[model samples]
Target: MDDLGVTVSAGSYRSTDPEAVHFPHRWSDEGVAVQAAFTGAHLLHLSAAGCVLNDVYREAQRLGVAVAGVRVSATGDFDTDTWVSRGITYSVEVDSPAGADDVAGVLEAVDQVAEIPRAIRAGATVRRVPAAGQE
Candidate 1:
């Protein structure tokens, strides 16, 4: 039921599902570590939150901080009947030796670079075009 798809110029594609379309990519590729989703709003929510959390973890690691665990959940006021999300909220929990100050910084950092989360929070325009010689 997803109408959107992604084309990565050549190597691989992560398209709408339940087709589960995935292409083989070399383990050495940067994308090997970054998975994409085309599963609509909820998947977007998860991806956005995850992206922020990943960044936080990366920065924490660089700072020599140990984060034992991290969990993120998204809740929203969405109208399925209207096919729109009215409001969304993200909740995060982290088990770490980093104090409240550091955790607060992580949260702030999430605000700065969670692209997908920001996309959901601020709606976007999406268009679909026919592939290659299709009509």
Candidate 2:
């Protein structure tokens, strides 16, 4: 779907010292709750992983597949000195009564719908711009 694209409401309110930021995100498309923790990189990864898992489970349910026996696990491999992720190993194991082929098909479909997996497989480019008086 997403004919109109996803809609979300997010805002960040930080204190005067700017030591920390309180960020909140809401799903405006369906009045759902989406949360984000304003911590560092590690916490951000956990939040992103949790969002991906929820997205996968929701898609499976919409396709009439049972995900009660599903297990999702993820780990991060990163170098702090370089401040980059070497890789993220994530997997999903489904224990449905369906046959092996069926389970595989369902997982494939889920992966197709989840955004994070697609982004991971096909890299994205980012260009940073300096703010008005920063440079």
Candidate 3:
């Protein structure tokens, strides 16, 4: 995540970073840690990582699995000339006290329901509308 990717870590895996943007999280008292530059590309990846991290906690609770931490990393590249995204890929790591199988089940469930990742996977049409006062 140094140059080509973005990472979001929460719970026990979260490293203290005063500069990182923190958001309240239900599973983690310290919330989530965002370590990424403010750029279109980084923001794009951050969206995915953030979604996955949240889903991990959500699914864990739904499945009655105990999760201590979660870290999600997302990476992608764009066609330099056109600036079209090549693709985005992400991985999730969970620190848990539950059995491996239980955690795995939660991860699998999150993968199926993580909204941002699913949206990116299916793609979407973008449309622009002028401001109410101007054309």
Candidate 4:
């Protein structure tokens, strides 16, 4: 089993600062669109996109294919009425010296094993643990 962890702290809604926390890895919108910044639905799509991009390159290397560049766009629809993610769609463009069939094969292999999408598709349970000092 593969395990990964990340922590996102709440940011001040009234702050002028870009990020709520000073952590190096924190993502901010320059204090604009704070609500969207913290929305889990948006972050979920981003995570899936990031996973696909990383896996593309990794799989390319493993397949001995030289990829000049890669771009992935992922979008998910959220049903506010039901508070659920309805579906997700993604498109990938890869610049490579390998033949089209080879590149396609690589992409398929990556899709099969990319972590985030797999977890989401498999319905992984999220267990929230309170902070150490929390009651």
Candidate 5:
């Protein structure tokens, strides 16, 4: 991921920034940390990154793999003329004491099971409904 990327990390790599916003998690006591700006493009990548981070922990536990931390970063570009996405690319990292093959297995499972990434891969139906009492 480059400068235009967004990252979400949790567990051992979770942010300690005073200004960082954290979201509640079922697996971690400190929650998840977000390391991106407030923008549409960042938000789009963030959804993928955050989902990956969460899935790493979820899938690890389900597989009985010990994951101490997780980080996911995603980046994308757009066609300036149409503002259509050029697609997003993402990466994942996990800190664990488990065997390499175990960690790899968990990562593979997460890749197949993460919901946001699947939704994006299948394309999305985005629509704007009229605001209350406005239509």
Candidate 6:
């Protein structure tokens, strides 16, 4: 089977607050070695939202609809027991000159075809291999 791969590098610690320069002193002092600039859960939501936004634009173009802007927000609850996401939700707002029915149709089509959500719903197997020089 053909496999697709993506790689990301770890980032240093960062503050959650927009204005803060760094995480609070207490968290920094706790000797947390595996800190990340952003959490994995947040990245998952971002991926979904980004896919939806891009699909919306692509579908609108194909349908000959003029869109001014698109906004999508996604959130999900993580189940501690299962270590998996539960009840993911996303809200989409599109600024367009098209009729309401046309806009709605575009959104619905995008929802059906967004890749990340489709992958999650269909389920994909993930395997880890050691990085070069690690083993």
By lDDT, who's the top model here? 3
lDDT of 4 by residue, 51-94 (tens): 77668767888988877666566777766678677766666777
The TM-scores, one per candidate, come to: 0.61, 0.52, 0.91, 0.70, 0.92, 0.70
Which 10 successive residues of model 3 have the least lDDT summed?
1-10
lDDT of 5 by residue, 76-128 (tens): 98887888888989998889999999999998998899999899999988999
User: RMSD to the native, candidate 4?
Assistant: 10.5
Extract clashing residue pairs from model 4. Answer: none
Error of 2 at 109 (Å): 1.6
Put the candidates in lDDT order, highest first: 3, 5, 4, 6, 1, 2
Model 2: per-residue Cα lDDT over 3-122, one tens digit each: 111111111111223333223323112222222334354453544454555564566567676544443455565575786666555565555666777767777787677777566657
Clashing pairs for model 1 are: none
For model 1, what is the alpha-carbon lDDT of residue 96? 74
Two-way TM-score contest, 1 vs 5, winner: 5
Q: Give candidate 6 misplaced runs (Cα > 4 Å).
A: 1-37
Off by over 4 Å in 2: 1-41, 120-135
Candidate 3 lDDT by residue in tens digits, 3-117 = 6688899999896878777888877999888888889999999998999999899888999998889999998998888988889899988899898899889989998999998
Backbone clash pairs in model 1 (N, Cα, C under 3 Å; residues 3+ apart or in different chains), count: 0
Error of 4 at 33 (Å): 19
TM-score of model 2 relative to the true fold? 0.52
lDDT of 2 at 90: 59
Cα error, residue 110 of model 5, in Å, equals 1.2
Candidate 6: residue 79 lDDT (0-100): 73
Model 4, C-alpha of 27: deviation from truth (Å): 20
Error of 3 at 35 (Å): 0.3
Q: Provide the lowest-lDDT 10-residue window in model 5.
A: 1-10
